[model samples]
Target: MSLDNLPDGLLLEILLHLPLQSVFQCKCLSNRWCSLISTPYFTHRYVSHLHTNLQPFTLLFECKDDQSITRVLATNSDEPELKSLAAYVHRQSEHLWLEASCNDLLLWRSKDDGESSPMSVYYVINPITRQCMALPPITLPYHRSWIQAGQFRVYIVSSNTREWSESKVLCQEGFELTHFALCAVPYKSLLFWCSNSGRLLGIDPYNTRCCRSFEQPIGWELDKETDCFGVCRGYLRICQISMFYTRFSSILRIWELKDYDNEGGGKWYLEHEVSVNQLVSKKSPWLNEHVQQKYPLPLVLAFHPNDGDILYLAIELKVLLCNLRSKTVEVFCDIPHDPDTWNDKCNIINFVLPSWPTPIPFAPLQNGA
Candidate 1:
């Protein structure tokens, strides 16, 4: 590896654990690891270390601000007049900013992401200790004759609370099984795991204690689609849906919520069923050793909003760069097509998806109906 004693940030920290088209073909391998892997903190430290359930520096919102006001962005890449770091603001939400982000937290939701009404998340705020809280929106409580709190969703198994009323949990509403999510539990801690909502809980983040409830494992299916997005694939929290189901071809379906507790209702189960075409054939030759990648698995991961245990999956259709530490699977359908077409059809439409969470304007998801 001698180009004159290579160390460009340790070969961009091993090309930030290589895989985002091999960090852009190692930037033609030579302009100094292509400006040290095209700095954005080298894909934010290759996605915040590729895992450990992540958290490194995220918050890329801009629902309006460009001058219209309503911010909370971040990228103060050491600021120089806000390379991007706006911070926070929500007096009218302006037009909605965050939809999901973790590891320095930010998931902001006012009433969008399919908008059925009653949806909330804005906890985990430390805009440098300004302190914030206003969660409990994604509604749905349960049993008043089978669900109705506008239909359900408040899935915040945990939000790294800084003040959450003194740490959460109440269950109240109508409780029989309400439906919940927003999770993290690989090395343990950070949760809100429920489905069809039974009795398995673990609260704190100021919803205030029940601490741990149990019993769950009947049919199991708590994915009240907020476009169903989750990440944490080795201790499972997998949930991702690009909409498919030749009757559940199962492009991913995991649910392993344990800490033990069963009161005839929940302990939850079904810990397996992910086959995005066998993770696109085990990520085709390890994503052809990086450049144009590939993927297919029941894939969908998040937490690369700008690195911190860098886990970003949602392959061949956006949110690229899979695998960093624990759950790193890669296969962009042999992404190479300068003309091979990465195997044509616009590589099934422009190498799937590797851009757009913001820059605003988004659409596409209707194919096949």
Candidate 2:
């Protein structure tokens, strides 16, 4: 019997076993194949199969430049599906800035474009399905002049809602919410925004009233510039680097949240501590020859999604993947380092690509004749 005459159930089983790229190509063979591959059941089954079989995931890096151009880099550079999605997103809106990523969905926002109002529209995009949804504009409440003594409002919206809702978050006697523009870090069902003072504002999209404040880790200094927050291997982790001026050395400490839903919030347990100076010793190739500094501080960009021991660090202009347990380092990539624009113009996003595309919830379908 010919392959075309195969039963739908058998065809789906065969297609599910193919590589992700091959499956994507199968969608273009005919309308019947396209419909078969595009069904919700197919996607769910394919994703489950990939998870059960332990398929590898790709790490996609997205950054924006001063010219409002977005650049996407992936660990698996030869993956055509991811590359195509990145290029399509770039072509759709050159000014779109990636704010956050959860699972397979990317949250992006267009630049203000010098509008008189401070609010900017947000978009949630699914690369595989090429579905885009525009969220209602949100007016920031952290404006310096708009402060109302001890309280501020946080605007939030959900995928199912068309309008934005506000929640009043009270601050301490002297503390104020100042860093509302920073990208939110999505952990489990809650989204967390970190402030310069080491405070975390967590909000639940489904429950507009469920807003909570998490204090900084015990004994942590109020230095926000050197702190990085991320989720690694099913745990919410935060990494901080401390520089010693007299000794010309730095220490990196990572903490994992124990119980996020506890009545007293969560407690951070020190998960890992590595000496940055020792990791990049004098004989290490990570040291730049041009810079004569004895100890070059490394910025923790992100943690390895699958491995808790591996970390991605940015030292000067080079990005390095360092293993804490083995004390080994490898150059991941060289990033642009323009001193003039580095501080104010750079945005980095760590995107994890699963084996199968995830369907976007509540996204409107494209019109097909």
- The number of the candidate with the highest TM-score is 2
Q: Model 1 over residues 139-208: C-alpha lDDT tens digits?
A: 4433224442322233334334422232234554434432224332212343544444333344443343
Which regions of candidate 1 deviate over 4 angstroms?
Answer: 1-55, 58-69, 73-96, 103-173, 176-369
lDDT of each: 0.38, 0.66
Point out the worst 10-residue segment of candidate 2 by lDDT: 286-295
Query: Which residue runs does candidate 2 get wrong by more than 4 Å?
Result: 21-35, 38-41, 52-70, 74-79, 89-92, 115-119, 137-150, 172-181, 222-226, 262-265, 281-295, 338-341, 361-369
| Residue-wise C-alpha lDDT for candidate 2, range 289-369, written one tens digit per residue | 322264356666677777888888765666677888876676777665532234434566666667676666545425320
- Each prediction's TM-score versus the true structure: 0.24, 0.80
Alpha carbon deviation, residue 181, candidate 1 (Å): 9.1
